[model samples]
Target chain A: MMRRKLKVAVFKFASCSGCQLQILNMEDELLTLTDAVEFTYFLEASRATAPGPYDVTFIEGSISTPEQEELVRRVREESRILVAMGACATAGGIQALRNWLRLDDVKRAVYPNPEWVKALEHSKPVAEVVKVDYELRGCPVSKERLLSFIKQVLVGRKPYLRREALCMDCRRKGNVCVMVAKGIPCLGPVVQEGCGAICPTFGRGCYGCFGPSIDARPEALASRLREIGMKDRDVARLFKGFTGWSEKFRKVIDELEGGAR
Target chain B: MVSGGIYSGKFGELRKLFNALRLRGYRVIAPKLEDSVIRLKEVTSFDEVPYGWEDIQAPGKYSVREGGKHFRHGPDAPKRILYPPRLELFRLRPDWSVEYPKERFPPTALFAIKPCDLASISVMDRVQGGIGDPYYLALRKKLIIIVENCVEPGATCFCSTMGTGPEARDGFDIAYTRLDDDLVVFRPGSDLGVELLSELNIEPATDEVLRKYYDALKNASLKAKAPFELERLPDELELGLNSPVFKEVAERCFGCAGCNMVCPTCFCFDVIDEPELDGGAVRVRVWDGCFSYTYAEVAGGNFRKDLWARYRHWVLHKFAYWVRQFGVFGCVGCGRCITWCPAGIDLRETIKSVVEWVRSRGGS
Candidate 1:
C-alpha cells in the first residue's frame, strides 16, 4: 500500500469552536495524524495558514450569516473534498433552534436593536449552502470517529460511518433501556448513532445531539412520548434540540408545535 | 427428556453451583442488579446475583424492585453472548485470501437463565447451525447452560403461549425450580450436571417434596397469561400481507430495529469489509435487521422501502417465515422486543391486530 501526501485545512462559521478544538484534543493521534497529512490551515492549532485547493478541508459550524453563506460556498470550491465536521456544520446545531421562533420576535427577545441583527432567517447546515463530501455528526464531533474518517480518507476508502439509531448502540452497550425503565421520553430511537449512547449510559434520555438517523421516525417517537405523559410541546422541544433544523425533524416540529404551547 | 432424580436445596445453595462452575473454568453469567435494572452480566461470585429482585415489564415499561423472585430479568437477551452483536468474520489478506479471527471463546455457564431464553438458543442451533454459522456453533459448544424455572412471569411474558417456558425439558445441563415454600428442586440433565450436583452434598428429594415441586411447576405455567397461540399466526400473517393493521402498526413503529437487536433468535447481519488503520481490511458483520433503512437494499434499490413493509417483514419472519425456514417459530416469547421498544409498540398486540384484520377479511 502506498501513502499519498495530502494537505488538510480547517474552517469555522457560527459555533462554540468545540468541534475545531476536537482536532487539537487528539493528543495521542496527533503524532500519527501529523505523519499522515500536512496541516495547511488548522487555525485552532497553527498560526501560519496556507492557501486553498487543499486535499481535504474540515469546515465546522453552521451557516448563520450571509457572510458565512458565501464563505462556505468559497471553501467548497477551494478543496478537493469538503467535510462538514459537527452538528452545527451538518444540521445547524443547538443555535438552529432559533428557526422555530418568528424572526422579529426572536430578534426582539435577544437583541436590543432588532433591526441591526444580520443573522440569516435560519441557521443552516453546510450542505444547505454548498455540497459536502462527508459529514461528521455530533454537538462537537467525536474525536475518535473523526480520526478514523481521516485515516480512511488517507487510504482512499469510503469510511463506514454507522447510520443506525442511538438505541441500537445503547442496547449493545447493555445499558438498561432508560425510556422503558423510567417514563423519561428519549429521542434515541430517531437519533443517529455516533455519540456511543452517552446520554442513555448516564441514565438520561438522549437530547438528539447527533441529529436524526437515516430511518428517523419522529412522529412515531413523538406519539409514544405523549402516551408516557409528555405534552406535545415537551416532545416537540425534545426533537427541537440540536438538530431541529434538519428536514425530517423540522416537519415534525412544525406539526407538533401546531396548537402546542 | 432426561428427567433425573430431583433434589431439594435452600435458597443459599445456588451459590455452590456457581462456585462449582467457576472451579471448572467456566465464567458464570447470571442476572445482576445494576443501573436500576437487572443485567445478564458475568458474575465472579454468587453475591452479584440480584437475590429477591423482581422485574416489572409492560409494553413499554421496565423496572426492578426488591420483593419477589430473583431469577427474573428484562430486555438483555442471551443471544448477545452466543452470537454477539458485532463479529469479525475474517480479515482479507494481501493476496485476496482470508484470515479468520484467532479468538477463543471461554466455556461459560449461563446460571439462572429463564427457560424462554434457553429455548432461544435451541432455535439458534437450528437456524445458525443449519446455515453453518461457525461463530455461533463454536460459541454454542463452549456454553454450559444452567436453566432456572421462571415461576413469576412478567406481564409481557407469554412463554406459555409459545410453549417454551415455565419449565426446562431438555438441552440444558442443570435445571433449578425455586418453589414458594423456600426450597429449590434441582435436576441434572447431563453427566457434567450430575458431577456438579455432587458438590451440593444434598440427599435426593423425597416423593412428597418431588410431587410438591412438580405441582409448583405446573401451577407456575398456568400463572402466565396466553394472549394467543402460534398455530394460526403464520397463516394469518401470510394471508394478511396487505392488512391495514401493518400500516397502522407502522404509524407508531420507529423502524429503529431496537426490537431486532434485543431479539434472541434474530440472526440477520450485514457484512462489511472495513480497512483497518494498520492497512489490512477486515470483514465484520454487525447485527442488522429488517427495520434498518438499508437492510433490504440491493444494487438497484431497497425491497422494504416503506416502514410498513419493514415492520410487516419483521413480524412475519418470527411468526411465519421461521416456521418455513427452520421448522420452529423464531419467537420464544421472552418479550424483550415488547419491553425494550421505545415507541411502546407491543408485538403481541400487533399479532392480534393482524389476526383480527385477517379474520375481518375472511382470508384465514
Candidate 2:
C-alpha cells in the first residue's frame, strides 16, 4: 500500500527572505524535491495558504513582533517536526544586532510612530519560543546541505555534518593561508565548516557566516588576534557581525572586553 | 656506527633494480627533474633520474641546475610530493551522488626522497593517516619509502629544530647516504628493505664502512640550522594573542592563501555535491582556505567580517586551538609559509612581535 506524501511547509517571519530565496535558487534540484515531498505552504513561492497538521515545517526568520511570537507557537503546535532554516531562525539572524543597543533608541530610529509599532525589543530565534527538531545553519543555508537535510528527513536517515572548523575546508581547498602569507585576520578556526570554505578561496578570510561552531573558543581566538596586531575594538566588532546576538559570540565578545571592567 | 654494502656497479644498476621491481609488478616512482623542479614522476629506467643536477631555493625563487652530480636537495625546491599544490581527490558526477573512482594503488617504491622531505611525509602521515582516515591509510599502506640523506641542506631549511634532519631516522623502509667515489651506504630499516637488498646480491658491510656512513649523516644533521623555540610556543602564543603585534603584521597582509597551499600539514577541506544532468550527483571533498571572507559566512551575512579576526583565527588554530584539541602542535616548522608568502610575512617575525607585545602588556 502507498503511503500519503509528507506535507511540508516553509514559513518566514521578520527577515530579508534570503533564506527562502536560497531555497528557490536550488533550481536544478527543486523539481526533484517537489516530486518527493508535498510542499503544502511556502508563501515565498506560492500565495496559497494551507491550514494545520504539517508533517514537517521549515521556519525562517526570527521573532521580532508579538504576533509572530504567537504565530510561531501555533505553528509549532500544528507541525510534527519544526526545522529552523538559516541563521535568522537558528541564531536570530542580523536583526538581532539590535539586541546590543537600547530598545527605545531603536524604536525611535526606525518607526515614525513608536506607539503604533507593536514590536519586540530584541530579535530571537524560533527555539527561544518553541522547540526545534533540526537547524540548517548559515546566513543563507548551503544549498547542498539544505537538499541533503530534506532528503535525509524524507528517507528517515540521519544527515551527518562534518562539524570541523572552516580551517579544515580551507586547507583542503589548497588556498594559501591568508593569515600566514598575507597577514589577513581570519575566522577559519572557530567558525563552523560549511559553504565549502568559499571566502578563503577567493583571497578573503572567513566572516563567520555559519555562526559560532561547536567548541568555538572565540575568546582565545580574539586574544590571538590581539597578538597578531588586532585592536580590542576590532575584535569586538568582529563578534558583533551576523551572529553577534548569539549567546556564545556575545559572551566571547564580553569576555574580550575584560568582563566590562 | 658506519655501515657498508658491496658496490652495486653503476648507478644504472639501481635503475635495473627499479625496473626489475616494476617487472615484478611494483609501481616505481622516482624524483625526476621537470621544469626545474625535482618532482616525483613514474619512471622505468635510470635515465629518468635527475642526473648531474641539484636545486637552489629561497624565498620567491626556485631553480635546478645541472653539473652538480652530487645529490644535493634544496629545502626551497618545491616539495611537490609531500605538498601537492593540486590533487584530484575525487571526481564527481553532475548529480550529488558520489562514486569512489577505482584508484590504481600499486605497490609503490618512492626512490630518492630527501631526509627533510621524508620527515615531512611522516608528519603528514601522523595527521592524515594516523587519525582514522582509511583513505590516506590505504595510500600509505602500498608505499615503500627510500630516504636519501641530503649532501647539503638547502638555504631555507630548518628541519633541525623540528627534530627532522638531513639524515633519515625511523620511518623509512631504506636509508641511503652518499659518500666519496660514487659509493652509497644503504641501511635497511625494514624487512622489505632487507629483502630488496638481498635481491641486489650486495655483500654486507664491515664495521669501518658502517662508521663512515654514521659520521657523514651526523655531520649533516649538525650542519642544519635549528627551528624556532617550539617549547615556549603555547604560552608565547597565549601571551602574544593580546598583544598589539597583529596589527603591524596584518597591515602587510594581502589576504592571499598561498601559505596554506604550500604547507604540507595544512589539511582543511570542503565537501560539495556536484549535481549531474542525470538523477545522480557526486559528492567530492576539495581544498578550502580560512582566509576567504565567505569561509564562515552563511546565507544571511558574515560573522568574522574583519581581516583581523580571520587572521587571528588562522594562527591561533595552528598554535593554540590545534594543540588543545589534537594534543600536538599544528606546525611542523617547515617555513614554507614564510618562504612562499609573496608579501614575505615571516612567521618567525610574527611570533617575535607577539612575544614583544606580551612583554609590554606584562603578560607571562
Candidate 3:
C-alpha cells in the first residue's frame, strides 16, 4: 500500500519575499521534502496552481491590504493546519514600523495618489485574521528550524521550538557577549531565539528580528541600556524596529515613553 | 608519589611541555585569542597560547591589549571539551534496534586552566562520576588537567571569595605561576605532573623565587573583592526571595542564559531525536539552561513563568540549594557570568541586594 503524500501550499502577502526565498534556498533538502509532500499552490516556484483544501499551508508575510486580509482568511479555510513562517506572518515584520506613523502619510510618501492604493490601515500578523497552528520565526525562518517543523508535522508530532532569548544561542555558541564585553547595546535579551544569535557572534547587537520571547522583559533591558549610556529615544527606537507591532515590544515602548512623562 | 612543593620550571619550558605532551600521544588544548576573544582550542605548539596578552574586562566591556604578562581565563572552560555542546546519545535503526555511540574520548591535556575551573572539574567529577555517566567518565579518564595559578586575576574574578582560586590546591596534574620572563614556578598535584617535571629536567626554585611567586598570588587575591558572606548567604537568600531585589535584577535580565552557559559548574541539557527517512533516528543531547522558557515547562503549565522567578531560582540554586544538594557552592566565583552577561548585571550586586533586604528584615 502506498501512503498518500501530504498536500502543501506556500502563500505570500506583503513582505520582502525573503521568507519564501528561504524555501527555495532548501536546494539540498528540496527533493527529500518533495518526496513527502506535494507543493500544490507555490506560485513563486510553479505557475500552475492547484486549488484545494491543503493538508498544510505555510504563510509568509503579513496582512497589509484588504485583498491580503481576504486571501489569508480563505487560505485559513482551505488549509487543515496553517503555519506562519518568518517575522512578517508571525509579528508583522519590519513593515510594522509603519504602524507608528499615519497611514495616509506613508501612503503619500510611497505613492503619488494615496487614495488610489488599496491598503489596510495597519499591517497585521496572520494570527490577527486567522488562527496559526505554529510559527517559525526570524527575519527569514531558519532553515534547520523550518525543516524540523516540517519533519514533526509529517510524523504527526508537535514541533519543538524554544521560546527563549537570543542570548541563549549566543552563549551556546560560546561567542563573547557583544553587549557585555564590547559595551555594545544588544537586543538579545528581549529578542526571541532562532537566528542562532548571528548578529552578536558577528560583533553587532541583535535587532530583534524574531520578536519577543515568552514574557520578554524589555523594560528591564531598556533601563539597562540607559544605564549603559543609550539615550532613552534610541532605546525606544530599538523596540520599534522589526516585529515592533508585537505586544511585548509595543507595550515596552509605550511604557518607556510613558515613563518619560 | 608526587610531593606538593613549588619547583622552578623555566619560562621557555612551556614549548617543551607542549612537545612532550604531543610526543606522549596527548593533544594539548589551550586558550588562544580568536576574533578578539580568548577561547579554549587544540594547540600543537606553545605559540598557540595567547602569552603576554591579557584581556581588560569590565562590566559590559572587554579588550585584548598586547604586552600584559597575565594569561587570564577566557570564557571557554575545560567542561566544553569534556562535556561538549552536543553529544550523540544513540541511534535507532530501521530494525527497531538501538545502537549506542562508541566512546571517542581522545588522549588530551588541558593546559593553562584556571583554579576556579579546576574546582569546577571536581564538582563535575562528583556529579557525573557519582552518577556513572559513561560519556563523562570516559572523558575524565583521558584528561590530563594542567592549570595555571592566578598571578594576575581578571577584573571580574572573585575566586578568593569562593575559596576556589588564586592558587589551585588540588584536582590538577600540574599547577604553575609565571613570575616574569626569567622565572616560572611549578607545583605537582599528581604523579603524572611530577613525572612530566622530571622528564623536562626542570630545576628546583630557590626560596627567593618561591617567595616572589607566592607574593604574586597574594597580590592577585587582593585585587578581587569576594562579595558573598557565605555563612549567612543561604538564610538571607531564602528570605530575600520575597524581597524586591530579585525583581530589580530581573528587570535588567534579558533571559539570555549567557550566565548559565559560561558558568563552569552549570550542568543542564536537553535531548532531541532526529528521525531519518528509513524510520531510523539519531538521539543527541544539547546544552540547556533554566533561563529558557521551556526549562520548567510541562503539560498545560509552566512553573517559573515569570522572569524574576527564574532569575531568583538561578541565584538561589547557586548560593543556597547547591549546598544541600551537592554540599558545594554552585558558583565558583569565576565571574564569567558577569563578564558574559549582555546587560552587565553583576551577581555581586544582586547578592548585595539580597544582603540589604535581609538587613531591612531585622538583620538575618
Candidate 4:
C-alpha cells in the first residue's frame, strides 16, 4: 500500500485565471493536497518551480494566441496526464464567443494596427489543440471536484463526475422546479450537472457555465423556449454564452441565428 | 390531546393517527406548503399541514388558491423520501476491497399518501422483486404507509382510468376518506392498523356518514378519466416508432429529467466513485433518467443519442416495456409528469395522440 509522491503542475493560458484561483480556495484541503502531490510548475501559488516531466499537469483556460497554442502543445508533450480544468480549458469558455465573429474585424476594431495582433484567429479549448486525458468542466472549475480528481489520480482510480443534466441535482436539492413553477426558460435540462445546480436553486436559469452535458438537447430545449414565446434570436443568444464553442451548443446557435445573426 | 387517546375525540379526527404515529417513534412525513409548492416533508405539528390550501394544476401551469375543498397531490411524492435521489452504495479501500455503508434510517410514516402513489410503490416493489435494493429494503422495513382516498381529485388526475387510484384498495396499512362534514372514515387493511384502530375510543362510522363518504368517492371515481387505451398502447407504440408525435414531444422537452425524478416508479441511477484523500473511494448511486443523453452512452457510442429516440424510449418503456418487465403498468396515472412538465407536455394527450394516429391508419 506504499504510494510514491506524484508531481503535479497547474498551467494557465488565455483565461482570467479564476480556475487557478479556485485551487487556492481549497484552503481546507491545501495541506493534504500538497502532501499528496508535489507542486511542480504552478506560477500562481509559488514562485519556486520544478522541472518538466510531471506526473499530472492541469491546464486551465483556452488557447487564444499562437504563443499560447504552442505553449499548450509543449505542456502536453511534457506531462504524462494533461487534464483540462474549467470551461475555458474544456469548452473554450466565454472567450470562445469571439470565435463566431471574424478575427480580422475584431482585431481592427480593438487595435488601430491590426498587423500587430499575433493571436490565433479563433479562441479554442485545450482539447481542441492537444489531447486531454480528462476534463473537469465548469466556469471556474469546481474546487471540490478538482480535489477529488487529484486524489483519484493519486490512487490510480477513475474520478467520479456526474454527467447528468442539472435538473437531477436541482430536484435532489428539493428546489421547486423553477421552469415548471415560475415559467422561466431554463437551460438546466441541457446543462451539465456540476456547480450543484446553483443558478436554478438561486431562482435564475442556467447559462450553461458547466458546459453542455454529454448528450445535451439544446435544439429540443430551444423549441420549448420558442413555444414559451422566446424569439429565435434570443434562444441563439442564450446558447452563445460560456460554452458557445461546444459542438452541440454551437450547432444550436447556428440554427437559431441562421448561421449569422 | 383527548383523555381516551385518538379514537375518543371524534370520528374523522386525523390528528389521532398523526399523534399515535409520532408517539410510537415514527416521523410523520406529510404535505407541507413550502416555496409555493406542497412538498412531502417531515412535519412535527398538525399546523404544519396545508389544511385549507387547494392546488390547481394544468398542463405547464400550477397554482394554489385558498378555500379549496379537497387536498390535491403536489409535485413531491413518497418516492423522494423513500427511495431518495442520491444514495451511497459502498466504499472502496486502497486495496480495492468493497465496504458497504451500514447507516440506519429513522422510522418513517408517509402520511396522507394518495392511492396512485401507493400503487406506484407496488409497481416499484415488483420491479425490485428479484434482487431487492438493500438500501430500499432497509428503509422500507421501518416504514408505515397511511393512504388517503382522493375524495376530490385534481384536474390532471387520471388514476381512476389506470384503476390505481381515487381509492387505495391494498398495499397500505390504513386508508381514510375525508367527508365534507370534516369526518374521516377510516378503514384498516392490516393487523397493526386494526390494533391501532381498536386502541382509539372511536365509534363505528354511522350509516349516514358512510353513505356520504361513498357518494364523494363515487363522484371522484366518475370524474376520473382513463385516457390511455392500454390494450392498444403496446401495439401503437411498437408500430408508431416513426410517429411524428415523438419528434413533436421532443421539441418541447428540455430533457431535464424532471418527469423521471418526480415519477414514483423510475429507479434508474448512475454510480459515482469519489476517491478520498486517504486512498479510500466512496461509491454513490445518483438518480438518472432515460431523458438524460448520457444514460444510454458507452465508450463506443451512445444508444439513444437523438432526443426523439430518448423521448420515445422513455414513453415506450413506461407504457410497454414496463408492463412486460414487471407485469404492471409503469404509470399509475398520477399526472405529476403533466403538471410538472416545463413544456406542459401532457402524457394523456400524448398517449391519446398516439392512439388516434394508430386509429387513423384504420388499425385497432
lDDT per residue (tens digit) for residues B123-226 in model 4: 87777534687777777778888888998888888998888979898988888777754567777777777766666656666667777777888899888785
Which ten contiguous residues of candidate 3 chain A have the minimum total lDDT?
A252-261
Q: For residues A1-261, write the lDDT of model 2, one tens digit per residue.
A: 134677889899988888888878999888867776778899989998788799899899989999999999999999998998888888888888888777778888999987788888789989999999988888888887887777666655565565546665565454444554456777776777778888877778777778776546576567667877889988887877777666778897777776651
lDDT of 1 by residue, A31-68 (tens): 76677688898888889988988999999999999999
Candidate scoring better on lDDT of 2 and 4: 4
For every model in order, the fraction of real contacts preserved is: 0.72, 0.05, 0.77, 0.76
Alpha carbon lDDT of each predicted model: 0.84, 0.68, 0.84, 0.82
- The candidates' interface RMSDs, in order, read 1.6, 9.2, 2.0, 1.6
lDDT of 3 by residue, A111-164 (tens): 988889988878899999999998889888898788777776777677777777
Model 2: CA > 4 A from native = A1-3, A257-261, B1-100, B104-164, B169-220, B223-364
Candidate 4 chain A, run of 10 with poorest lDDT: A155-164
Task: Give the total clashing residue pairs for model 2.
Answer: 69
Clashing pairs in 3: A180-B60, A220-B251, B8-B205
Candidate with the larger DockQ of 2 and 3: 3
In candidate 2 the C-alpha lDDT for residue B160 amounts to 62
Which regions of candidate 4 are displaced past 4 Å?
A: A100-117, A158-160, B1-12, B93-99, B199-202, B362-364
lDDT for model 2: 0.68
- Native-structure RMSD, model 3: 2.2
- The TM-score measured for candidate 4 stands at 0.92
Give the per-residue lDDT of model 1 (tens digit) for B1-364.
2236888888767878888889989988888888778888899989888877788888878888887765475677888888887888888775667888886688889998999999998998898878888888888888899999887788878788898988888889999988854688889988888888877856688898888887877877786655677777798789988888889989998877889888998887888776655566777888888788877777776777888998888889899998998899999988888888878788888888788878887887
